[model samples]
Target: MASIHILLLFLSCTSFVYRCDGACAEPESDTQAVVGRGFKLGCLSCKRRSEVKATATVEWYFKAKGEVDFVQIYTYTEMGPTIENEHFLDRLDWNGSKRSNDIQDASIYILNVTLNDTGTYRCFFNRILNYDNYEYTTVVSKVVYLTVVEKATRGTASIVSEVMMYVTIIGLQVWLLIEMIYCYRKISAAGEEALREAANAEYLAIASESKDNCAGAQVGE
Candidate 1:
């Protein structure tokens, strides 16, 4: 029982770490945004060393279809989100990590989007990793080309990818459950067999002792 509990605890810890580890993965964001709807611009920049303490500031820039150059629109830091452009005032909100200084996901949400919002957006992460001896700085950036549309449509590839992801997740979970059940059954069978062997040995020892007593009593009489 103690061994089973320990195994369960270890499995729980492993799963927690697997789910919580904000490992860097640069997935492409959806390019389509429906007008008059809220859209989230995805951005992720995970630290290579999670154990090392770090602080990050995120900056967002935008360049319209006929723009000369990119203009800074939004910025977020420990102080909170700041909208630098009046065009995006009260329209942009930080949709990423809120509680920690080590910001991993730097996504932002745009409310009541418009055709004017169509452009190329860039997310920049300026991070400082604090080590015992010194601090190291690193910069990472991700760009997304977005288009405003009258109606939202899902691409065939996106739908297929989502379906495949769900299938894979369910398959892995089912396999893990089956493995756990098999392991429990095997352990229980071994334990029962051990108990049965011990019971048989005790019975045999008691019977042999009674037979010796009977023989001694008959000899005395």
Candidate 2:
């Protein structure tokens, strides 16, 4: 009876240890969003086993049209350039610089976002190494989508005022584009004119010297 009890106690302790080794599994965040007019994308969560003494690498993936093969939007490792997708080359940035094994709450900032920024994003945490040659674990958060809408100002107004505001904003944008093109053309034209004037001056000097030489030859003859 004493031997049987000892064996049971050993089994119980082994099970407890196995459970506590990786008991704090990372939790995923729900779908979050921000106002389309504001300069914000959303916050994401990433975490790993608390007891594991390993660095975590975070990566963000994005997909349009709900496709399975998502493209990599951003990647953060130990040391290197933060890899970004071609589409978001200049718009996306890490919101903060906080890192840990249990949980990482990182936000992303997007500037001057348009309708094309709307899509599904997934945050991932990959363990850097495994204990005693154990396989590394990867945890993924739920997909989040961004919805952008036109901003409404001055309370709820009549349809005419709303339409006028949109039209005015679009018109201003078009005018600015036209002005830029005009300025570029003017600068190019001035540069060409300067080159033409310099060439004409060189030719005039050569012609004047040739005329003086011809007059001198006639006098000698």
Candidate 3:
């Protein structure tokens, strides 16, 4: 009996993973929940891919870590989200649109998240789309991967920190460019001074030779 129970649990978990990936043909959503903090599960159905039936239902399922079973957390209809699950009875709030006739924006807000609430959540919309007198029943879904943590550190840089970082980088680049220019000018000036000295030396040598030749001609005369 224990082995049978374990097998059933394993199948349930595997089945849940398969269902979350297989049935969700719509856009996906994801979120994070810090331990003891609140978070939001976002789902948008704006300009829906298809028309919904008059009596459509929205279902939300959750699969926790190390667990093979997917729990039916909450559901929504024209009335609102039904708090049927014990785990999310008081913690779940309907943050989605209240339009049952045309259900869209199916988001949910979770309060006081705990480590046990971390899992994969899948949302499904079972509707009968109108198609030229034929009512086609279809299921559109979105998968939300929610992670819960016991300790969450704020890793996002503040606005001032980001601005300062950019400023520092730009300053370093400008300083490097100035240094390069200064070095180039100093090298060029040194080369020009060496050329000037060599030219003066050559001119003095030519003048001395001309005087010596003049003295030799005078003595010969």
Candidate 4:
């Protein structure tokens, strides 16, 4: 019975760890956006193997800087490629004609682009998997930075934006370092307190036995 209980506990802990590590989660792809007026932004796979199942829906969205509106340019569903935004209707084309749910070789072409297109773009997938008697849905999102510029002059906005972003990242790193140092100190203090308590308990036990021995000796005399 004890062995069975130990095995059950081990399996429970393993399951919890697996779930915390994002089991059945859709993996994200790396995105790169270039500043050339007319260039293609490519999405590369971090890993070689294609683990995503077939019949997943992939969608692309473009959001201009300082704009709340999200323009849906391309969407691949079971029906076919549906293009909603007229501005990108002619300019945007898939690099590859072939589309597979498992393989993500999606690329977008922007021709005769202007500076207004500079913003963050994202690619995501809504995955549905049928298991046993039910279906489950999971969403995965990845972002890319796109900066459009003139043919002759470089845009200062992109550069300034990048610098500010780096500064914010550095600030986060500093905060994390401070938090780690604080936690280390707190843990060390707690460990010392535990050791002190154990030592005090040992001394008290020895003192109690010594008092009892003295009383016994007096009684014998």
Candidate 5:
């Protein structure tokens, strides 16, 4: 049992590490941003095979609300991040992969967003996969259409989800409380029965001993 517990702990730790390294899940970016707040443009391009080593560079482009062409806004490579557009200078920051060059998450963040910032943004990834004898290259792109508003509004779906989550939590707590009460009552009843049986056995033993003493006295007489 001890060895089994140790093995289970090791497996859990391994799974946690694997997920932390990269879960490789792609979630859509939130397209609504309130003015004067920060917003993150999410983009993830995961490698199909993790065993193969790879290096990647990311480039971000933006088109203003009524722009005819998309302009390069930012780029992140091994050399580091560079802001290419004057409009987003010092406002755009890299919010994605770090420590290694195998860029999977290429998201970016914008500080103090404005109505002028509302438009379509594009994230492009150039990845080079390294094999034993050869190297392969691939390109991946994702786009997000953003709208800036003065005040944030919660969607009906979001409200419903929150209500459901609270309901589920309350239900689980009630169920757990009922189970604990049931177990306590069962154990208490069993303890009471055991004590009663012990008391009866003691009484019977004392009576028998007294009767034997009386018989011995009568014999002496």
Candidate 6:
């Protein structure tokens, strides 16, 4: 819950930062789960950005693979979350902020997840604010790409394959860190060389001027 609030603070700043880097501000995350198990879909809204605030609402929708339209499954607002979808029935759990009315974490844990759940889930956070008689809205949304599988094989071969994949990922991360350090050092060295060259050129120009003045004075004398 503490982490959720921290994340909200970070995301709220991006809302007003302009659209140039909006893509990075809100990145779609993916989650994998096995069938007949429970999975949580994470979502958070302004819930309330400022103390002098307005109303906040959250909605979750689902779109199966190859589908164009999304269906609403859950919603939360001042009235609290109401599982509106008949399909989810009694399997939906509000495992989010304790305050149901104004929820910070709209994350929902779905019980007995099935293969049909494989697809994209969208979480919408709508905030209506009225400051100084001017009403405005700040909306924050997130996409969760859920991949549900019947079963994940855990045989000897599978174990080896998983281990190798993990190793590859770790190796790539290490390589990237090393590359960043090398690049930083190289750039610093180049900057130092440029400064040295500029200083040496300035000194030479001053020396030339001094010699020319002395020669002229001697001639005059």
In terms of TM-score, the best-performing candidate is 5
lDDT of each: 0.93, 0.65, 0.76, 0.67, 0.94, 0.78
On residues 64-123, what C-alpha lDDT tens digit does candidate 3 reach at each position? 888898889888886666976898879988787674555566778889999888888887
Q: RMSD for each model, in Å, please?
A: 6.7, 26.6, 18.1, 12.1, 4.5, 12.6
Off by over 4 Å in 6: 1-30, 46-52, 152-221
lDDT per residue (tens digit) for residues 197-217 in model 4: 999999999999999999999
Ranking by TM-score: 5, 1, 3, 6, 4, 2
Candidate 5 least-lDDT 10 residues: 1-10
* Candidate 6 overall lDDT versus native: 0.78
For residue 171, give model 6's deviation from the true position in Å.
15
Between the candidate structures 3 and 4, which one is better when assessed by TM-score? 3
Clashing pairs in 1: none
TM-score of each: 0.64, 0.44, 0.53, 0.45, 0.77, 0.52
**How much is 32 displaced in model 1, in angstroms?**
0.9
Ranking by lDDT: 5, 1, 6, 3, 4, 2
Model 6 Cα lDDT, one tens digit per residue, 149-191: 8896455866899999999999989987987788788889999
Give a tens-digit lDDT track for model 2, residues 1-221: 44467689999999999888854333343332344543544444434444555665667887764566788888766562275787778777766345544335445676666666667777675555457767566664646675544553343445778899999999989987887788788889999999999999999999999999999999999
Provide backbone clash counts, one per model: 0, 0, 1, 0, 0, 0
Q: Which lDDT tens digits does candidate 5 get at residues 1-221?
A: 44477689999999999888845778999999999999999999889999999999999999999889999999999999999999999999999999999999999999999899999999999999999999999999999999999999997889999999999999989987987788788889999999999999999999999999999999999
* Model 5 ranges off by over 4 Å: 1-24, 64-69, 210-221
* Top model number, lDDT: 5
Error of 4 at 198 (Å): 79
Candidate 4 positional error at 188, Å: 62
